[model samples]
Target: MRTTNRPASGTVQSVDRAVTILELLAVHGTAGVTQLARELGVHKSTASRLVAALERRRLVEQVEDRGHYRLGVGVLKLAGATTARLDLAQEARPVCRRLAADTGETVNLAVLSGGAVLYVDQVSGTSTLSSYNWVGQHIPIHASSNGKVLVSELDGTELTRMLGELVAYTPSTVTDRALLEDELAQVRQRGFAVATDELDVGLTAVAAPVRDAHGDVVASVSVSGPSFRFDEARIAEILPLVRTATTEISSRLAHVPPER
Candidate 1:
């Protein structure tokens, strides 16, 4: 017998309002009911109802002033929960280590989370100048090689929604949305990406996409270091090696799929 999946039907207005309240708090740092109602274009009573529901879930908390709300500790808890089980961090560690050892440059494994590229794994290089490990760090999508390669997979609307306003991380980061679109187009055509001091001064990275059996990009593998050693020529030299390592890791992941 065949079964049909029924579409959900419920009062999603409250949910939407709650999300709006969260977004407003994230953007404004804190807000009172009146401000939230105005931002959401909803009635004061409706905003109050939404805030009440969110308060019950610990997603939002009333500030000490009694009239304002801000994001609660529950959001941190939820974020931590995701950080604890980032699968790429676990699966890519050894691969990254091998790549770093072979290339004598820092190797990174990153996944797109929210609007940023989350560095879940890093293997330090042999260079003494290569700074601290970057595990659990986030880099902007338009300012990192891995981020650009990952962003290349997204549709235009989804990409715009993900990047949102394109705050410049550094002077070199592409802040113009149209220019970034053109850059992403180039990344797709090139099959890899290079970022020179876009995220930080004197830092450079070369990244290639890791694809699954279905040939869809799942993560990125990158080699990153200071500009003194990771120049344009050096990045071009290592691009093939990074791409090779990415293919190996993707094959391993496809053969031994991680258990959910």
Candidate 2:
């Protein structure tokens, strides 16, 4: 689906106020519209409208007798997804540590979030100086090895919609749509991606797709370090290890490789 920027300040404030109402309800366990309006410093009618919207989505449910609202099952469903992400991180922690140790490079677990690469976990190398922290950070989808691997399965039309501008972060960043498509094709064939100074002037990374029980690419396992030390020879040496780590992680997620 095509996305457009929110056009109105009132619309943005309405969304923010709605989220604050949810937060308030979460904290107090339950609240009436009047109390929410007082906390939000908005008119009672405004609070009612926000709560009404939330109710439509099952994010909030009204206590008909008490005239109050509480968080609904939708919140639990969202929280469950987060819990699964945490589980994935925990399960991949051992493999990330081993990869970092074996290559003396920083290792990361990332997933596609809002058309970007969200780094969920990280393991540092033996050398503290070479290690970089990126846990809980989102990077552009078109500029990183992890991002490429995550989107490798997308078809041309979907790829176009997903990557709108292909903004360049560095001189080496591939901004051409056709080139990126070609690179993604190669990534699929090789089952991995290598990005050399594509996202940053001196950063390099190699990533392998991490599949889930259904054999879907649910995440990516990447080894990243300074470009100077991540030369072609070093990359070749550790590529197998990176691939193995991803396979192990996928196995932890119950993804069984088909027997040859």
Candidate 2 RMSD to the correct structure:
5.6
Sliding window of 10 residues with minimal summed lDDT for model 1: 1-10
Kindly report which residue stretches of model 2 are placed more than 4 angstroms away from their true locations once superposed: 1-16, 27-42, 62-68
lDDT of 2 at 175: 97
True lDDT of residue 102, candidate 2: 93
Clashing pairs in 2: none
Candidate 2 per-residue lDDT, tens place, 91-159, comes to: 999999999899888899999887789999999988548555788898999999999999999888877
- TM-score each candidate: 0.65, 0.85
86 Cα displacement, candidate 1 (Å): 4.3
- Candidate 1 has which clashing residue pairs, if any? none
TM-score of 1: 0.65
In model 2, where is the ten-residue run with the lowest total lDDT? Answer: 1-10
